[model samples]
Target: MLSALLVTGLAACATQATAPAVPGDTALGPVLVDAKRMTLYTFDRDNAMPGKSVCNGPCATNWPPLVANAGDMAKGDWTIITRDDGSKQWAYKGKPLYGWVKDTKPGETTGDGFLNGAWHVAKP
Candidate 1:
C-alpha cells in the first residue's frame, strides 16, 4: 500500500512539473511552441523578404508553414502567396513565410539567427 501511494505521488509531481503554456504577445498573436516537435510561429509574416522564404517540406513538417484562410482579410504587412498547390500562404513581400521548430514560447526568439544565414525572426 505504501509503495502504491509513493508511485501515485511521484506521478502527480511529474504532471505538475511540466512547463507552462507560452503566453501571447502584444505584437504577436498566438505563438505555438512544441519542444518535442520543435516548431514556432508568428502572428505575422515579418521575416519574408520581397520574394523569398527559407522553409519548405520536411522543414515545414518541423516548422509548419503559416497558411492563410480564403477570404482572410489582410492586416498590416501581411499578404498572401498562392502556392502551386493552389493554397494560399501568408507572406510579407513576394517571399513566403514560415515558423521555426526550436522556439518554445511566444516571447522566446530561439529560432532567431538559426542556421547561420538562413532562419530569422519575423519582424513586425
Candidate 2:
C-alpha cells in the first residue's frame, strides 16, 4: 500500500504540465530541479510584482516559469504572481525564477548564457 501511494503521488506530480515549486520549501539544494516534476525552485525574498518577468519571448521559451496556483502566497522568501496571460509563476527577491528547457537533467545549469550575462543559477 505504501508503494502504491507513493507511485500515485509521483504520478500526479508528473502529469502536471506546469508544476510550480511548493512555497516555503527549498528544492534539493542550491536550486535543484525535480526531474519527476519538471519544475525549478529558488530560495529568496520575492517582492510582490505582477506580469513583470525578466525572461520573455525567446527567453521564456527556454526558461519556463514554474506556474503557480490560486490561493498561493509568499512562503518565507517565495512569492506567487499572475502573469499577463493569467498564468501563475513563482518569484524570488522580486525576480522570477525559471527552468531552462535545454537543461535535460536535475543538475544541468545549461541556461547560463550571455544574455548580456544576466541569466544565472537560482540560488537560495
TM-score of 2: 0.59
Best candidate, TM-score? 2
Q: Give the TM-score of candidate 1.
A: 0.51
Q: In order, how many clashes per candidate? A: 6, 4
Give the per-residue lDDT digits (tens) of candidate 2, residues 75-108.
6566676666778787765567777677675555
Cα RMSDs of all predictions?
11.8, 6.9
The sequence of per-residue lDDT tens digits that candidate 1 reaches over residues 30-103 is 44333333334432233443444445557666655666665554444556666545666766534455666555
Error of 1 at 20 (Å): 25
- Candidate 1: global Cα-lDDT? 0.51
